[model samples]
Target: MCLFTETRIKFRLFEGCAAESGTDGEVVLGVEAGTYQVFALPDHGSAYGAQWVGLTGGTGSQDLARNVVVAAGEQKDIHKIFMDRKGTVTGVVTGADGAPVTGGTVAAVTPVIGDAGRGRVAIDTQGRYTIDFLGPYAWPLSFQTSTHAFQWSGAAHRRQSATLVPVTAGQTTTFDQQLALGTLVKVTATGSPSGRYAVAYNNSNGDVAGFIWVQQAGGQAIFRVMGGQQVKLQFAGGEPGQGWYGGTDFDSAKTVSIPATGEKVVVYPYS
Candidate 1:
């Protein structure tokens, strides 16, 4: 068997606002030698690795929790920076009636803070989905379907309660979720300001769904979600007004619901 695959690995070295790319797993730069953040992206469907600058050649633990220092005329051997094979995560999204949720989207979100190692896959007609390039460990995942509301791996509306799925390298970890459709509410908001307004569903703790609606001209910002669900309206790019429903902080944004079929909320942002 071949020892290495043909997948291309990319390396990104970051030093504050400056960045450099190395396709051969090692990068060289002509700048001041200081500490830098090391980020690795591989095409073999693996999670992106982020750590401190630690380039070693011997069979010892590479120190990645600190910065890397490069000196003049010193050649750093980063050939050991290789991407490992990605693990697999497979699962099914079902409804409260024990029926399969077809055409749903399953996302394997890593708890790594940034958008690294997060993978999304579409549920097949049989409500089955497989996400690759994952680490061999528990992954906090979420699902969204047309007939069901957003639910985490723990069957809860909150993402913090989502259970971590244990994935295996070169193997598949099977998991499933049962969801229920919540009350659908029509949401609309209008405000006056030089900034844009964004709307999303919040459960008094964290965001539940990843959907958002943005309105920039103080016009209609429309969407639908669970009724009476705590949603947040975020304002950006402008200051708030001094009138009613106007403030300089996040509390100035309006939280509304579809109490009626065609009702809308008029918020004053820059009045």
Candidate 2:
């Protein structure tokens, strides 16, 4: 199993600037002149974990990263980052019919500074999966299979509603998932510009059910939502700019009610 671990490091330069260091152990990044916090994250499944420039033990927190001031056209060398060994999570994936799911993926998401630390692994033929090299923290797990809708660890659809699994270094945690059927929602956007648009379905709790990109104006995109769930549709990056369906903003947007599986909902033009 150790051979399957990925040995790459991701260097984050504060905000959104990032660079990847491969097996050669070298990385170069160009950024604007400013004060930035530098941190490195080892790829998921690696025995090593994430850490700041000067911090060891793989705390995986950006607050611990050292602050460095860089002037325009000035080159600075960040010290080597040291990481500690991480934990592992293993489980079995089963379908709604109580049978083991043959093929799929399980992902663990950890909330961190700037961006979340994520690790994903494929389920084997026996429906077993092991996510290695996760920092010691409470993580939300997401399961996806070709025949079932994506679901969180507690069989919840939203991240906020899912269960948080605890992980500890030098130990293994067990987490299992059972999937449920999802409702299919088809949205049609008309009277918009002839460009790609992203349609997102957000629930009342501000949790996104799913999103898809429409290739052209008047085109349609489909995504899955929970059955009998009420959600609001938000459109972005198209002719009329970003806005919610039935209204210009989130507060005024009309709520869409999803029917059962095999049913479809068509969203008309944005007013």
After superposing candidate 1 on the true structure, give the runs of residues whose Cα lies further than 4 Å from its correct spot.
1-21, 24-84, 110-118, 190-198, 201-230, 234-271
Deviation from native of the Cα of residue 259 in model 2, angstroms: 6.5
lDDT of 2 by residue, 1-271 (tens): 1111111122212223256776767777666787766545566447775443433433433334466677899998866655567778898888889888999677653212222234457899989999876667666677766576566788776555668777788899998877776777778767655554444444545544555556676677676666656777865663343546787765677788777568667767854
TM-score of model 1 (CA atoms): 0.53
Q: Rate the local accuracy (lDDT) of all candidates.
A: 0.47, 0.61
The parts of candidate 2 lying over 4 Å away from their true place are: 1-40, 50-84, 110-118, 124-126, 191-198, 201-208, 213-219, 227-230, 235-244, 247-253, 257-264
Extract clashing residue pairs from model 1. Answer: 45-133, 241-269
lDDT of 1 by residue, 1-271 (tens): 0011110111211213232354544445444454433433233333532112234311111122223456666654444454344567777778879888878667643111112222356789998988775545455666766675566687655544567677665787788777756544333334444334343435354353424335345554444344434555443334443322334443554554423233334454444
TM-score of each: 0.53, 0.59
